[model samples]
Target: MAFMKEFHDLEIQLEDIRSATNNFGDENIIGIGGFGKVYRGSITHSHSKRQIMAAFKRLDRRYGQGDPEFLKEIMMLSRYKHEHLISLLGFCKDDGEKILVYEYASHGSLDRHLSSTSLTWRQRLNICLAAARGISYLHDPNGTQQRVLHRDIKSSNILLDDNLNA
Candidate 1:
């Protein structure tokens, strides 16, 4: 009873905040998609000492309120730890706004590099190998198919770190 009321109140507050936020695509939006806009943010409220950019995805209300895929991804990622996979730092859910906070990649998508004249054949081959290995693990015979489908396979999804490796 009390919890429900609290949740409802929070939902209303979130909607107000969402509405008040700047037009996501106008400036701060680092990425945009059919479901939401990913904005860049700082780590002021978090416990981390090092400052790294974060991807703040605000779910688009036009699609529908709340996103099941986003929730499922966060819920599953919360239970485990891995290197190849991107970690979902946290998620904020409310009546109208659902935000997913993630570590931002500085180099942008692998495709951006691959499409450029600088990407050597060796680098492209390396990326292919890395992605194949990831897909194999996700599609392991013993593992359930739906656990991590890797359904959205694109050069943009592959992120490289400072060392130029996945």
Candidate 2:
């Protein structure tokens, strides 16, 4: 418990998460993956008292991820910061729940827009470039000797914002 104190600012109460996500209601579900379901919700900052839309990834033990994996993800994300990389806003680890809160991508994942006729060629190129940059940063983070390998690299893993940037 003492080790977790380092992340106090990034720790979010489970009650707040439940409230924002309507108790993890089906209506708020945005995506489902191996880890679990991702819900779209809004959480009010404890300090700022400002509400922000976020994506909450609730861990499902049946999916194989547990506390160790959850902690690893939090540590990695907390250490790394890049424009194209998804931002980790906060996390919930109360009541036997492990949830990662991320900045919401209004446009959703890259795979969803791949088949759309509305996606222009330039937009697709830009998305690819942005994703590449993010990957590059992870592989060789600035001023770090450690090389981070993203075992999962897929269109669905790449999220896009309102501007179609990945």
Candidate 3:
């Protein structure tokens, strides 16, 4: 994939990514979706040198989305910054490997909670509002750029923070 100019600063060395993900060990896997498997790992902060949890999405070489879609996602993520959206920390494209790094959603996917326990009326409402706002922000045509259509929307896609705030 030919990365655009915007990818220059966000490019993460494949070695670093590999190290952070412990070579993508099975234990690191947190979820699996249509594109690839998502892993939980910790990378050292650039400035603080402290370990920070991160979600490492390594695209499957054989069955995952193509380079065009991957590149498009990187482009879109690099351009958009919203509070409700997951932050793209960086990406890796090397040795025929494609990987994306994002902020860790501590509480995990919303679906995890739905089946395990009963949510209070208030908690359910908050989850709904947050997901709606995120979708609304992505679909708003009045933004500086064109609206983004999220092809996937489901309980599993709705990540939650440490506080369970969607």
Best by lDDT: 2
Clash numbers, per candidate: 0, 0, 0
RMSD of each: 5.4, 1.3, 2.0
lDDT of each: 0.60, 0.91, 0.83
How far off is residue 73 in model 1, in Å? 2.0
Model 1, span 1-166: residue lDDT tens: 4533432311213332344334344566777665677776555324554566666767886766456766665656554444655556666675545776666666666877875887778877876787677666666625444456667888778877654565
Q: Which candidate is the best by TM-score?
A: 2
How much does candidate 3 score in TM-score? 0.90
Models 1 onward score TM values of 0.70, 0.95, 0.90
Q: Could you arrange the candidates by lDDT from highest to lowest? A: 2, 3, 1
Off by over 4 Å in 3: 1-3, 46-50
- Candidate that beats the other on lDDT, 2 or 3, i.e. the better one: 2
lDDT of 3: 0.83
**CA error at residue 154 for candidate 2, angstroms:** 0.7
Of candidates 3 and 1, the better by lDDT: 3
